[model samples]
Target: MELGLVGRTNAGKTALFNLITGSTAEVAPYPFTTREALRGRAEVPDPRIDAIADIQDIPRRVRAQVQVVDIPGLAAGAGQGEGLGGKALGELRQMDALIHVVRSFANNEVAHPEDAINPLGDAEAIDIELLLADREQIERRLEKVRKSAKSGDATAKGEQGLLELLVTEIDQGNPLRIVGDAEALALGIGMGLLTAKPVLYVINSDDPGEPLPELVAYATSRDAHVSQLAVGTELELAQLSPEDAAELAQEMELGDVRGADAMVRAAYELLDLVTFFTGSGPPEARAWPIQRGLSADKAAGKIHSDMERGFIRAEVVAWDALVAAGSFSKARESAQVRMEGKDYIVQEGDVMQIRFAV
Candidate 1:
C-alpha cells in the first residue's frame, strides 16, 4: 500500500515523513522545503512477526512495509497551478491513500504561509484546492464523454449523467466521498479523483494533548481519521537510540509507542487491509498486507505470480496457533492447520503456506 503526505507549507510533512521512513530528507522551517515528492517504504510493526520468527527460529525476518511519499507543501491556488502545485497534486493521484499533515504547533522559527495558526482554516484551504482540481479533471473528462453520448453511446450517456451530478456536488463544496451510489463512487475513483481517495488527518501539534474540537469535527464530518503527533519531539526521539528514546518518551509522559507506528497502523486501518504471514521455518519469515477480503489465490499472487499460477491449496493456521504448536508439522498433527482451496477468503493473522505445483 502507498500513502501520500500532503498539506500546506511548513506543516512538518517532511519531518513526519523522515521519522516514518527513516529517510534523511531535509526538513527546514520554511515552506516548500520539499521541492518534489520523495518516496520511501515504512515497515508496518506487528508483534506476530516476532512471535512467529522466535518460535520458528527463523534466520531472516521481513516485516510488511507501506510505501510513503512526501509531496511538497500545497500553497493557496495550487489547484490553479501555483508553485509546485501542479506537480505535487499530480503525484498524489497515484497514491493508495492521503495523509494530510495539518500544522497545529506554534513554532516561532517555522513559518506558516498564512502567517496565522488556524488548523481548521488551513485544512479547509488545502481541501478546497483538492476539490477544485477534481472538479477541473471531471469537467475535462465530461467534455469527451459528452461528445460520445451525443453519438448515441449508452455507456457514455450514463457516465455523462453521473459526472454532471458529481460536478454539481463538487460545486456545492462537498467531496465525492459523500456520494452514496457505489457505481458513481467507483467511477470517480477509477478516474483518479483526488477527493475520492481515503484520507487521514495528522495534526502536527506541540501540545498534542490539547484537543482541537474544530478540526476533529471537520474530520468526523468528512468520514476521515485523525491522529495527533508532536513532530518536532518525535524527530528528536528518532535521533536517539531506541533505549534512550524510550527513556525520553517516558520522561516526556509519552508512551513507549512511537507516534509514527501508531499513525502507520491507522493508515493501514484506513486502507482496510489485513496482514498474513508466509514462513513456517528456514531462511526467512515475512508478512504480507492485502485487502481485507482477498482470496487464497489472490493472496498467493501477492507473494509470487508463479505461486498463484500453480496454486493447488493453501495450508493455513492462525499465527498464534502456529506459535503455540512450535512448528508447522506439530500444528498439522494437532489439527490446528486446515487445507483451504483457492477461493478461500484469507483471514487476518492467517499464516498461509501455499502448496502448489510448478
Candidate 2:
C-alpha cells in the first residue's frame, strides 16, 4: 500500500514521515519544503506473525510493508495550480490512501502559512482544493466525451450520460466519489479523482495524550478517523530502542501507545486492508495484505503469478489454530485445516499452504 502524506505547508508532515520510516528527509520550517515525493518502506507491525514464527521455529519472519510517500504541501487556489499544489496533487493520484497532516501545535520559530493555529480550517481548505481539482478534471474529460458522442460513438455516448451526471454533482459542491453510484465510483477511480481516496487525519498536538476534543469532533462529523500525535515526542521515541523508548515513555507519561505506531496503524485500518499469512516450516513466515473479500486464486496471485496460474488447491487454517497445534502436520492431524478451491474466499488471519502444479 502506498500512503501519500499531504497537508498545508509547515504541517510537520515530514517529521511524522521521518519518524515512521526512519528516513532523514530534509524538514524545514517552511511551506513547500517537500517539492517532490520522498518514499520509504515501513514494515507493518503484527503480533500474530511473531507468534507463528515462534511456534513454528521459522528461519525468517517478514512483516507486511507499506510504502510511505511524503507529498508537497497544498495551498489555497491549488486546484488551479497554485503554489505547485497541482504538481503535488498529481503525485497523490497514485496513492492508495491519504494521510492528511494538520498542524495544531504553536511553535514560535515555525511560522504558520496562514498565521494562525486552526487545524479544522486547514483541513477543510485542503478538502475543498481536492474537490475543486476533481471537478476541473472531470469537466474537461466530459467535454471530450461529448464531442465523441456527437461523432456517433456508442461507447462514448453511453459514458457521456454518466459524465454529465458526475459534473452536475461536482458543480453542486459534492465530490464525484460521494455522489457517485457504483459505476461512477469506478469511473472516478479510473479518473483518479482526489476525493475518492480514503483519508486519515493526523493532528500534530500541543502536548502528549491529548486527543484535541475539537479536532476529534470535526473528524467524527466527517466520518473520518483522527490520530493525535506529538511529533516531537514521536521523533524522540524513534531515536531510541524499543525497550528504552518504553522506559522513557513511562517516565515522561506519554499516551497509552507510541504516537508513531498509532499513526501508521490507524492509517492501515483506514485503508480497510486485511492481513493473511503463508506458513511453511523453514524458509519464512510472512504476512500479506489483501482486500477483505479476496478469493483464493486471486490471493495466491499476490504471492506469485505461477501460484495463481497453476493453482490446484489451498490448505487453509486459522493462524491461532496452527499456533495451538504447533505445526501444519499437527493441524492436519487434528482436522483443523480446510481444503479450499480457487473460488473460495480467503479470510483474515488465515494461514495458507498452497498446492500448485509445475
Candidate 3:
C-alpha cells in the first residue's frame, strides 16, 4: 500500500514524515522544503508479531510495511502548474490514500502562504487544488469520450455520461467522493481522480488537543478520517533514545501510543486492511498485511507463488492461542489449530501455516 503526505508548504509535512519514517530529510522553515518526492517504508508495528516470535523462539521477525511518499507542498494555482505543484500532484496520483498535513499551529520562524493558522481553510485550499486538477483531467478525457460516443460506442457513451456528471459535480463544488452514486465513484477512482482517493487529515498542532470542530466536520462530510499530532514534539521524541523518549513522553502525558504508530494504524484502517501472521518458523516470524476478506489461497500467494500453486489446506490458529499453548505442536495437540481450506477467509491475527505439495 502507498500513502502520500500532501498539504501546503511549511505545514510541517517533512517533520511528520521524518517522525513516521525515521529519515532525516532536510526540514527548513519555508514552503517547498521537499522539492522532490521522498520515499520511505514505515513498518506497521504489531506486538502480536513480537509475542509470536517470543513464544516460538524465532530468530527474525518482520512487520508488515507501507510505502510512504512525501510530496512537496502545494500552493494556490497549483492546478495551473504553479511552483512544484505539477510534480506534487503527479506523485499524488500514485497514492492509494492521502495524509493531508494541515497547519494548526503558529510558528514565527516558519512561513505559511496564507500567513494564518486556519486548519480548516488550509484543508479547503488543498481540496480546491485537487478539485481543479481533477476537473482539468476529466474535461480533457470527456472531450475524447464525447467524440468516441458520437461513433456509437456503448462503452464510450457510458463513460461520457459519467464524465459529464462528474464535471457537473466538480463545478458545483462537490468533490467526487460525495458523488452519491457507486458507479460514478468507482469510475472516478478508476480514472485516478484526486478527490476520489481516501484521505486522512493530520492536524499538526502546537498544543495537540481536541481537533478543531470545523476540520472534524469537514472530514466527516467528505467521508474521511482526521487525526492530530504535535509534530515538533514527536520529532524531538524521535531524536532521543527510546528509553529517554518514553520517560519524556510519559511526563508530557502523551500516553503509550506514539503518533507515528497511531498514524500507521489509522492508515491501515483507512485502506481496509488486516494483518495476519506466519508464526511457526526458526528462520522468521512475520506479519502480513492483506486486504480484509482475502481468501486463504490468495493470501498464501503473498508469501510465495509456489505455496499458492501447490493448492493445499492451511493450518490456522489465532496468535494468542498459539502463544498460550506455548508451541505449534502443543497448539495442535490442544485442537487450537484448524484445517482451513483454500476458500477460507483470512482473519486478523491468524497465524497460518500452509500445508501444500510441491
Candidate 4:
C-alpha cells in the first residue's frame, strides 16, 4: 500500500512523514521544501506475527511494510502549474490513499498559507482544488470522447454518456469516489480524476496532548477518518531510542507513542487493505498487504505468481487461534487450521501455507 502525505504549505506534512517513517526528510516551516517525493517503508504492527515468530524461533525482521511518500506541499494554483503545484498534484495521482495534513495549531512564527488555522476551511479549500482539477481533467477527456461519439461508435457513445453523467455529478459537488458501481465507473478510469481517490484527514496540532473537536466533526460529516498528532513532538520522539521514547511518553502522559501505527493503520483502512502472513520459519514471519476481500489465489499471487499458478489448497489459520494453540501442529489438531480453496476470501491476520503442485 502506498500512502501520500499532502496538505497546504507548512501544514506539518513532512513532519508527519518523518514521524511515521523515521525519515530525515528536510522538514521546514515553509512551503515547497520537499521538492520531490520521499519514499519509505513502514512496518505494520501485528502481535500475532511476533508470537508465531517467537515460537518458531525466527529472527526478527520488519513485516507488513507500507510505502509512504512525502510529497511537496500543494498550493491554491497547484492544478494550474503554480509553485511546484503540478509536480505535487502529479505525485498525488500515484497514491492509493491520501493523508491530508491540516494545520490545527496556531503558531505565528510558521505562517499558514491561508493565514489561519481553521482545519475545516483548509480541508474544504483542498477539496475544492481537487474538484477543480478533476473537472478540468473530465473536460479535457470529454473533448476527445465527444469526437469519438460523433463517429457513431457504440462504445464511444456509451462512454461519452457516462462522462456526461460524471461531469454533472462532479459539478454538483460530489466526489467521483461516491459516484456509482466500480464496473460502471471504470469507464472514466483513464481520466485520472483527482477526486477519485480516498482521503483521510490528519489534524496537525501544536500541542501533542490536545484534540480538536472541529476537525473530528468535519471528518465525521464526510465519512472520512481523522488522526491527530503534534508533528513536532512526533519528530522528537522519532529521534529518541525506543526505551527513551517510552520514558518520555510516560512523562508527557502520552499513552502509547505508536502514532505511526495509527497513521499507517488509518491509511490501510482508507485504501480498503488487509494483511496476511506467510511462513512459520525463522527470520521473522512475513506479512503481506492485499486489497480487502481478495481470494486465496489472488493473495498467493501477492507473494509470487508461481505460487498462484501452482496453488492447490491453502492451509489457513487465524492469528489468534494459532497463538492460542501455541503451535501449527496444535492448531491443526484443534481444527484451527482449515484447507481453503482458491476462491476463499483471505482474512486479515491469516497465516497461510500454499500447497502447490509445482
Candidate 5:
C-alpha cells in the first residue's frame, strides 16, 4: 500500500514523514522545502507471522512493508501551478491513501502559512483545495468526454454522463467517494482525483499530552479518522535508538511514541488491506498485503505469476492454530490444517503454502 504525507506549508508534514519513515528529507518551517516526493518503506508489525515462524522453528526474516511517499506541501492554487502546487498535487493523486497533517502546534519562530494555528481551519482549507482540484479535473474531463460523445462513442458517452453526475455531486459539496461505486471507481481511476482517496487527518500539536477537540470534530464530521501527534517530538524520537526512544517516551509520559504505528495501521484500514503470510521456517516467513476478500489465487499472483500459473491448492492454517499445534504436521493431524481451493478467500493471519503442478 502507498500512503502520501500531505498538508499545507509549515504544517509539519516533512517532520511527520521523517518520524514515520525514518527519512532525513530536509525539513524547514516553510513551504516547498520538499520539492519532490520522498519515498521510503515502513515495516508493518505482525506478531502473528512471528508466532507462526516460532512454531515451525523457522527463522523470521521478513515483516510486512508499506510504501510511504512524502510529497511537497500544497498551496491555495496548487492545481493551477502555484509554488510546487501542481507537481505536489499530481504526486498526491497517485497515492492509495492520504495522511493529512494539520498543524495544531504554535511556534512564533515558524509561522503558519495562514499566520495562525487552527487545525480545523487548516483541514477545511486543505479539503477545499482538494475539492477544487477535483472539480477542475472533472470539468476538464467532462469537456473532453462531451466532445468524444458528440462523435457517437458509446464508452465516452457513458463516462461523460458519470462525470456530469460527479460534477453535480462535487458542486453540492460532496466528494467523489460518496458517489455510486461504479461512478466512484470510474472517476477515481480516470481522473486520479485527490479527494477520491481515503484520508486520515493527523493533528500536529506542540503539546504532546493533550488532544485537540477541534481537530477531532473536523475530521469526524468528514467521516475521516483523526490522530494526534507531536511532530517535533516524533522527529526527536526518530533520531534515537529504539531502546533510548522508549526510555525517553517513558520519561516524557508521552504514551506510545506519537502514533506512527497507528497512522500506518489506519492507512491500511483506509485502503481496506490485510496481511497474509507465506513460508513457515525461520527468516522465510514473510507477510504479504492484499485487499480484503482477495482469493488464494490472487494472493499467489502477488508472489509470482508462475505461482498463479501452477495454481494448485493451498495448505492453509490459522496462525493461532499453527501456534497451538506447534508444527504443520501436528496441525494437519489435529484437523487445523485445511486445503483451500484457488478461489478460497484468504484471511488475515492465515499461513498459506501453495502447491503447484508445473
Candidate 6:
C-alpha cells in the first residue's frame, strides 16, 4: 500500500513524513519543499512477527512494509496552477489513502498561509483545492460518457448522472466523501477523485495527550479519523541512534517508543489490513500484509501466481499454537495444523505452509 502526505504549505507534512520514514528529505519552514515525490518503505513493526521469529529461532525476520510518498504542499488556486499545481494533485490520486497534516502547533517563525492557526480553516483550504481538482477531472470525463449516454447505453447513463451529481457536490463546496455509497458511485474509483480517499488527520501539536476540539470535530464531521503527534520532536528523535534516543527519551520521561511505529500502525488499521506469516524454521521468516477476508487461493496469489495455479492445500496454524507446539513436525503431531483448501479464509496471525505442485 502507498500512502500520500498532503496539506497546505508549512503544515508539517514533510516533518511527519520524515519522522515516519526515517528519511532526511529536507524539511523546511516554507512551502513546496518537496517538489518531486519521495518514496520510502516503512516496516510495519509487529511484535507478533518478532515473537514468531524468536520462537522458531529463524536467521532472518522480515516485517511487512508499506510504501509512503511525500508530495509537495498545496495551496489556494492549486487546481488552477497555484502552488505545486497539477503535478501534486495528480500524485494525490495515486495514493491508497491520504494522511492530511494540519498545523495545530504555534510557532512564530513558521508562517501560516492564512496568518493564523485555524486547523479547520487549514483543512478547508486543502479540501477546496481537492474539490476543484476533482471537478475539473469529472467534467472532462463527463463529456466522453455523455456521448455514450446519447447512444442510449444504460451503463453510460448511470455514469453520466453520477458525474453530474459529483460536479454539483463540488460546486456546493462539499467533499465527495460525504456522499453516501461513495464507493458505488459510477466512475468514482476510475476517476481517482481525491476527496473519495480515506483521510487520517494528524494534528501537529505540542501536547498530543490533549485533544484539539476543533480538529476532532472537523474529523468527526467528515467521518474521518484524527491522530496527534509532535512531528518536530519526533523528527529530531529519528535522527539519533537507537541507544542515544532511548536514553534521551528516558531522561525526558518518554517511554520505550518511536513515532514511526505509531504513524504506520494507524495507517495499517485505517487500510484494514492483516498480517500472516510464511515459513516455519528456516533461513528466513517473513510477514505478508493481506487484505482482511481474503480466501486461501487468492491470498496465495499475493505471494506468487504459480502457487495459486498449482491448486494445492495448505498447512495452517495460529502463531501462538505453532510456537507452543515448537515446530511444524511437532504441530502436526499435536494436530495443531489444519489442512485448508482454496476457500479457506486466511486469518490474521496464521502461519502457513503450502503443498503445491508448482
Q: Which has the higher TM-score value, candidate number 1 or candidate number 5?
A: 1
Query: What digit string (tens of lDDT, one per residue) describes model 5 on residues 1-358?
Result: 6889888888988887777777788988656688788998877766677777776778755877788898887788875666678788888888888889888888888877888877778887888888888888888888888998999999999888787787787788776766666755566656678777788888888676545776676676566788877789878887899999999989888876456776667766777786888865554888888988999988988998888989889999888888898988888899998999999999988988898876
Q: What TM-score does candidate 1 reach? A: 0.93
Clashing pairs in 2: none
Ranked by lDDT, top first: 1, 3, 2, 6, 5, 4
Candidate with better lDDT, 4 vs 5: 5
Measured against the true structure, the TM-scores of the candidates, in listed sequence, are: 0.93, 0.90, 0.93, 0.90, 0.90, 0.89
lDDT of 3 by residue, 1-358 (tens): 8999999999998898888888899999966778999999877778889899997789899998888899999999998777778888989988899999999888888898977788898999999999999999998899999999999999999999899899999998887888988898899999889999999999999776778888899999888999988999988988999999999989998886777687777876677788899968677999999998999999999999999999699999999999999998999999999999999999988999998889
Q: What TM-score does model 4 achieve against the real structure?
A: 0.90
Q: Tens digit of lDDT per residue, candidate 6, span 1-358?
A: 7889889888987778777777778877765677888888777788877777787788788888888898888878997656567899989899888888888889988888888988888888888888888888898888999999999999999888888888887788767777775543535656778887888888887654545787788888877888888788767677788888888778766677655577678887667787889867787788989989998888888888988898599899999998888887899999999999999999989998877786
* Residue 13 in candidate 1, Cα distance off native in Å: 0.7
Model 6's alpha-carbon lDDT is 0.82
Q: Which candidate has the highest lDDT of all?
A: 1
The 0-to-1 C-alpha lDDT of every candidate, in the order given, reads 0.90, 0.85, 0.89, 0.79, 0.80, 0.82
How does residue 190 of candidate 3 score in lDDT?
A: 92
Residue 313 in model 3: lDDT: 99
lDDT of 2 at 202: 94
Model 3, residue 301: C-alpha shift (Å)? 2.3
TM-score of 3: 0.93
